[model samples]
Target: MTTDLVAAVDIGGTKVAGALVDGTGDLLHRVQGPTRARESAENVLRAVTDVVTQLTEHELWHRVVAVGIGSAGPVDARNGTVSPVNIPAWREFPLVEGVRKTTGALPINLVGDGAAIAAGEHWTGAARGRSNALCMVVSTGVGGGLIVDGRLRPGPTGNAGHIGHISVDFNGDLCPCGGRGCVERIASGTNIARYALAAGWRPAEPDGDVTAAGVAAAAAAGDPIALAAYDRSARALAAGIAATATLVEIETVVVGGGVSQAGEVLFGPLRRALGEFATLPFVRNLEVAPAQLGTDAGLVGAAAACWSDPDTFLIRGEAGN
Candidate 1:
């Protein structure tokens, strides 16, 4: 199969981002659209169709063979239904089929946004050439993906990697999943600010506005409350990584997301906590590093998913796969 191009769409909580990527992982074109709450799935489909058709109609996307989509959590890839919490209208919605109908005849392979990041890391990011790695996105909510034994482990119904809900503390905090003390509840960028407020560390939030970025800025200015918030976040995040490493035997933990922009405030203490918590020595060397893909990871990883066979894409079939 001579190479051409593939269209990658990343359907996030607040937005739908799409890019036309080539075989070398270079994006040819990119565009985005808004994601409104309570907006019917049909409307979402219309918005996406408009952007994709606009791109494909331009002849720039002529060679595009397949479409790879990365959507929000609770997505059913086999059934091609999307039931994301942030977007209520998508409950059991047929996103892939809708787009397929609108985009002419093309094969659409779908996976969660977390899984797309994992595929991107394995294809060209931090976890490149490594097997059994944990790919985490610590943004508004903590999300995760895995490349175990060189295979994509998208749960029974393609919702396997909802790692944010993993309980880090039994009595920590109540998560949206009805679980108490989930990693996301305590460690996610959104939660970091919440936890800070509960501890009387008020930076700002007249309308619940203190974001992870705001917290980072305050901490940079040497605010004790912000420092405490980041510390707790690092502790919770590290504990989760340790447990996951033990369970999956992942060689590395590649961290991404906007909160990860806090840099050492999040990772430095994270490494220390991981070292303190990990019981096994082999798992200790699980180098925890920041993700390098930036905002383009989603699209590139979505495009990378089209190259399902690692051997064919990475040129090391015998090594693993």
Candidate 2:
């Protein structure tokens, strides 16, 4: 009746979540702490270590086997480093070693936050049992992971799923990656609101509702300006999805993130546009659905990854210590 365990860590711009994950991918002994973005990279790593320490010290944590970490991009999971564009402290930070040190030489698995989301879906969520699918996030920013032939493609530096960075329009807006018109810049929540603001929408109330969610609500309520904003964003996203389908022939697209809260308002038109633009007939059925795991997807995916490699699982020493 003993249970299997794994320590899963999710690092984001605002917070770091760590928990003991069972073989079933459910979290146990979960805890949280601030990411302290302005702090030094060492301080952030130290915070991650503190959380892992708590998990390892817990009385019932013995069954935990290894550690799997998901962090903000652009992560170099292969080399165990992170270079998140938003968090300046993490440039070339050695996060893997930090985890390993905290776990007493436990094997630590790492991947980009987007890839972790994909792994979570593939393991037990919406993308389960699918041969080709994408786990995408359209939150403050847009990002995603690719699964090809039912396998996670951790390309080159384990950052292969920079789908958001791909150009949706060459003559479109400039991107943080020094590119022009990336799908993320146009479709992300940030961009959605930015476009809405430029379209001459002013809030009547003092607080002001100038976010993508509010815009989506307005669009649903028949606001022409808001609808136009959503329309523009949805079209760009649809094009990106179609382009992805053209290459991978994906069967489903699982989208999550803050902006995805718009649901049908965002997806309906996106589906229509994808249908019209997707050239390959095989990709016509690329079903778009909401992500099931929400923010916990990263932790769940980390635990799920444990099932993929048993050798490393056995080497993890934290569960024993």
Candidate 3:
């Protein structure tokens, strides 16, 4: 059987990862380079170029027909530009142009990282078989994507489901994004640890790191402050999830990322809080499931973007089937 392949690129603050992926979602060859996000824009672009260069040298490179990119957004998919927040060097960077220049005239598909997660989930992860769903990543930050009526809805700019910046607490703390009490302000791992610390929680041993994972450990050990922090974060997440569901009526919410590794520590409270906020009859049956794709969602989804079938076209911003 002849194998068709696509070049997949996942670009973020920390790294630019690339792969040659077959139609079945298998990564035939992979390469990566540090993003060096604070450096000059040219330096960061060089890193991405390095990853692509390596992929082009792979034995399977000749079989690749198209290219797909899942990037940390504020992406202008309509114009093939990007302005990722964490990567300060890039502002309206011609990412598609850069990739095209390096890899030739192959069709290039670009989408925000959150939308890629949604695409991956809808294709093969926890959101599989769901007609409508939300896929979220709650780690250093909270990012999300929407699946509406069995299709991914990446708005014109490719950032339709940016649930992180949505205000959940009007009178609460100001977020770095200049929003008041955004969901990311409370539910992100950074804030989870910050909340615990502000509430007088401290590591038992000297010189111990203070992090959300540490807080989860303390919460598991019955620390009141730590448990309270998780509860607060969960409540904020529930509010955001409920709001999204009420607006679009998603059937399930698939969550991934580092903070979600807390397992029941986060989900137990999140489930309880969701029950309180998602009170509408239509959203009462929303299911919250752990994502199964782990760290590979971006890569798999990038490859998935190359296909223009009726189901996948939704993610590529074509009219729904």
Question: Which prediction has the highest lDDT against the true structure?
Answer: 3
- Summarize candidate 3's per-residue lDDT along 56-90 as a digit string, tens digits: 89888887777888898788988889988778778
RMSDs, each prediction? 4.3, 2.6, 3.6
lDDT tens per residue, model 1, 1-321: 235677899887777888888888888889888866458777877777776776677567767767888887778887888887677777888888888876666677788888888888878899898888888888887878888988767665555656787898998667777789988888888888887777777555565447788888788778888888998888888888888888878888999999999998888778888888776977888888899898888888888876673323444233235
TM-score of each: 0.90, 0.91, 0.92
Q: Candidate order by lDDT, highest to lowest?
A: 3, 2, 1
Score candidate 3 by TM-score against the native.
Answer: 0.92
Tens digits of lDDT, candidate 2, 1-321: 026777888887778898888777788779888888778988888878887888889886766667788788888867889988667888888889778877875677888888888888888788988889888888877778888899877566767766888898999778876789999889989888998889886554668688887788788888888888888888888888888888878889998888888988888888888888786779877888888888788888776765565446455533456
List the candidate 3 regions with Cα displacement exceeding 4 Å.
Answer: 308-321
lDDT of each candidate versus the true structure? 0.80, 0.81, 0.85
Residue 113 lDDT, candidate 1, scale 0-100: 84
